[model samples]
Target: MPYLLPPPRAAQPQRLLAPTVTHLARLLLTHAPAIPPLLTAILPSSPSLLTPLLSHLLLSHSPPLPALSLFRRLLELPHFPVPESALPVLLRLLARSRRYAHHSFQLLESLPSTHPHLLSVPALSVIISTALCASAPGASFAAAVSCFESAAAVWARAGRSFGAAELNALLRVFCARGRVAEARALFHRYCDAYPPDTRTFNTLLLGFKEAGHAQALDLFYHDAVLRGFVPDAVSYCVRMDAYCKKGKFLDALQLLDEMRKRENCKPTLQVFTTLIYGAGIVRDAARARRLFDEMEQSGVTPDRGAHNALMGAYVRARDLQSGMALMSEMEQKSFGLDDVTYNTMLCEFQRAGDLEGIWKIYTKMTGSGFMPRTRTTMLLMKVFCENGRPDLGLELWDYLIGKGCVPHRHALDVLVTGLCCRDVVGEAYRCFRELVEMGMAPTERAFRVLEGFLKKKREFGKIDEIRQMMKAIQLEEHQAEEEAA
Candidate 1:
């Protein structure tokens, strides 16, 4: 009987102790002036514990009082190095409050000098994005641009290289808002400071592609390759999609082959998906089918997006049988359909005015445990109204609301307008009032439709009440815009 060696004990990885928010909150609230020494004493080995500790306080749904109090206390400790991870969340929280918004900007402007480590790309992006979303039209752009320059200046002083990521973030913001020209100008202005990298060119390429600047996109791609920045899959995708948008499907396919032959650049799923979507837009079902098959042969297993894009092509080309067959195949693969899948089918049904098909898709969608989103709600309401079934539309609205779909003002507007069109004014008024009670105001067009119906029906009382409500809503919105700015 040979003695068996005991199995070697498995090594246990060290686990981080969870920060107790309650204890920290009590300390901050009770010993406001002594946070620094107390934190140092408690977290002697890990000052970074304050990171997750502050994150919990800031991100909680509880009233902002505790978080604000903690933040003020932490800010008072000039030597405390606020974690990079916490700054973005803290800025977002402060940006949401009218009084604290200025403090957030002040902190952003001062962070690189005051705490350079906390001036992360994500933190700057959050501040820039928040400023860009401000309600006052051009003022928002001005603020965003100002913040961008200020960050650049502060970062330069902190001996930090404001690199490609920070530049790309700002570029994305401008491009996303359809400010491609401005984004290009920004690229030019910063190229000297942050030498243009592959991602820099890719960002501009996508910006130009989205803005429909075909000539600029072409020129930029050539310039990038000439400048020794080898175009990656993304670069190829942007150029391919640009060609597709210009109705040059053959050229796009040729480029796809070109990328496949390259050393490191291989055709990605996006590459295939882009071609399929382009084919869909042109109603070229044959091309889409070929691309889908080629994608699988190339070892890029099709995801939901690829399947949906193929389906879109089939339906657009009036090949309903092929579309249904493809959908069945997707189900057979066991990945199951998602919101986009259902929505794609619904869009086709709606476009064809096939109310029966729409209902079938809706049934399947719900049977799969899918909840209706705003888009789904809008489509159903529109189709129902078009089919002279405002009653069903109203019922659908109630059902969706019951299922916790927050009332979408646009969808409500569609239902109300439909009701008014079909002379179901009383029901429309009731729905409008319900929306008001739910703290949403429908579109002005819906209001006008309701008002017109009331006037014809000699319901001056309801009209007067609605007018007053509209005035109050408008005033509230104006004040909110001011605060947001």
Candidate 2:
């Protein structure tokens, strides 16, 4: 089989100069039939750079189904070079984009019949690993277990057994769902085929730390060391994080000491920052300050993240002045404050009923080219609603909607809940109706708030209307749920 030579460079000399993904996407969209040949010709030149081009197309330009269609076309071609390097990137993009993650797995099932060259232990391992992060059926523990079952079915049908890494990813998923015992059971079941590695144990430790099972951390470490897995920086970080989380500050400090004594296992910036946050969490600002100084003394420069950790500690301690001073220092060092900084300040000022303070930070956030995030908008709107400034909340809503930006469902929920609480039930009703029309469900909290208002007013007719609407919505939700399954 002859290779697919490059398309006539003479015909498109300008393409050689730019070769931008956006430009290629335009070409593919306009000349859909040419995608396979274009890919066949171009991919061989630089698979590494061009692999990301396909991802850019999927994530930035095209939807999943159509983008996969193009990929399928390339795979089906007569002389196309196999897109081995690119497939991982494509699969990862699919897994992370919540609307399209399941399609990523579906790609795995399609591989045997269509693109077996793309099917391998390594590729499927990556797909399985990425799929672990994708949501399960219902986001419950049972859903998580079921997700593993479905993944196993996909594995069996693909005619391949999982490698250590894939199995570890599956184990991580189970542990993350607060089903640590299930993860442990699954690991033991497959230990002979794929024994736990350092990365595997690291994930297990992180999962326990996240799930708030500090006690499990020690058990896991003992098991790992007994099994001869060399403890690495990741191993210590997990335990240190667990220690910090559990308010074992001195213990966390002791672990830092132990880490220092180990050859090639010095405490990282992450370790120091973790301790600082832990100190902040338990209101040990003095210890946190000492850790910062210690970090600098150890030749680890305090980064923006370190400053943010201290700011968070100050916020927790209700010391806004100190937090502001910390912010000023970060700025003087040209360390840009992130959404975390602004959101923390916004929350602190909100608690103090300092409306002007809230506005001041918000203005700075917006002026500094920071787009409003979901949490930032929700809390800001909630403050307005709570402090008898629903008008300002509505203004912000209009501003968002005018720019064709959809606020988070929770933001809309806050608005409706606030309107009903403030006795603006008619506006709340309008907002609720618009949300439903937009094909997004209002939260049960929003519905209850509105229903409470209508009941207090004895609006019997409106109550009947709400009842009917509720039934219809429930039916639609059930049907949609079935369709998704």
Candidate 3:
């Protein structure tokens, strides 16, 4: 074989120009009024050079305004033709930052009027999804609706409708956040012009089920069937879960039987797990065990989720023996224990106030090299604090740091609250300081705990300092929210 000329290196111009372009972009951002002749000189030489430079600036987590300002300056250049590809990159960059979410929305809203050719389903979907995720919930919802309506008008002008996927994405976001009412209205608004698909119905069903609106979910499920849409596995799962949620196991079982009879809709692992978890919630360990058996018999291998569900049921029923046996079976089957399994056992032990059992699980958890998550850390810290062991709580904090897991503010709240309750004010103050050193502001709850403790101890100087620090944090956060808005 002819020596495959070592996959061609990056063109020399790109390698050389990238650094200079980045420097100039930074220079322009920092030192505004960058020499226009300089940009005109370099950019005109190779218009292609600007694409990577723009992408780099946008994606480098630089403040959005300065980068957008640079883009504007480049736009004024006569020779440099900024690629349309830059639009998506810029939109993504802005969407990712809470501070620039409002700006991203502005860009999205303007696309229909300013760059209608760039208005497509996927581009709109990205903005919708990103806004829903990256901004405050109330603001995100308003922005999503605005973006969708804007895109819908543009699509209508072109004699077309928004794709089902975009509609489903918006529906999913609404449903996920317990905004089923808004989601339902949105679905109905669009369903007439663009017929709803199976996913649309399933999404609504799941949303209603999750919101604990069983009656509404049941009605919606039947309504979808009435509209000639066949219920899929997800639909059946949602319905079954709704019944299970209400502890109407008889109804849930009936639905399961109906699901088995259906030729197309087979029960998935999630379906079984839902039922098992529901059974556990009702303390029906026998039923949960039988469901686990049925799941395996149905040729669905019991994955970590299935095992965890069964374990949770046992924990709920206080059947530690069965839980332990299942744990052994899990290990034997190579379905090694995960954070959920460990957390479940820890919860059970914590409830029973069995310090020995808690220690055993904690040791095993850390030994397994799976770092405890925020919730787990918080739970353990609370337990230790309640048990008069602030020392152990601090040790857990150190372990978390050693594992490179940045403990969340909620965890700090637990540790601080626990310490204050135990009158370990000194340790609590130290813990609070450590968090501040890590550059994370403690939650207001934690701050209040320290403030009250310091006040009680007559440490007026420290209280004033802490009050000042909290005020500064709140001011910074308020400014960020305003910027985001």
On TM-score, who's better, 1 or 3? Answer: 1
In candidate 1, which residue ranges exceed 4 Å CA deviation? 1-142, 151-162, 334-339, 420-427, 451-468, 481-485
Candidate scoring better on TM-score of 2 and 3: 3
**Evaluation by TM-score, superior candidate among 1 and 2:** 1
Best-matching candidate per lDDT: 1
Candidate 2: C-alpha lDDT: 0.69
lDDT of 2 by residue, 271-325 (tens): 8898899899898888788898899888888888888998888888888888878
- For candidate 1, the TM-score is 0.70
Q: Report the C-alpha lDDT of model 3 over 386-438, residue by residue, as the tens digit.
A: 77776667777766644434467777787887778878787788777755544
lDDT of 1 at 145: 78
Stretches > 4 Å off in candidate 3: 1-142, 150-162, 192-194, 417-430, 444-472
> So what's the TM-score on candidate 3?
0.68
Candidate 1's clash total is 0
Global Cα lDDT for candidate 1: 0.74
Q: lDDT per prediction?
A: 0.74, 0.69, 0.73
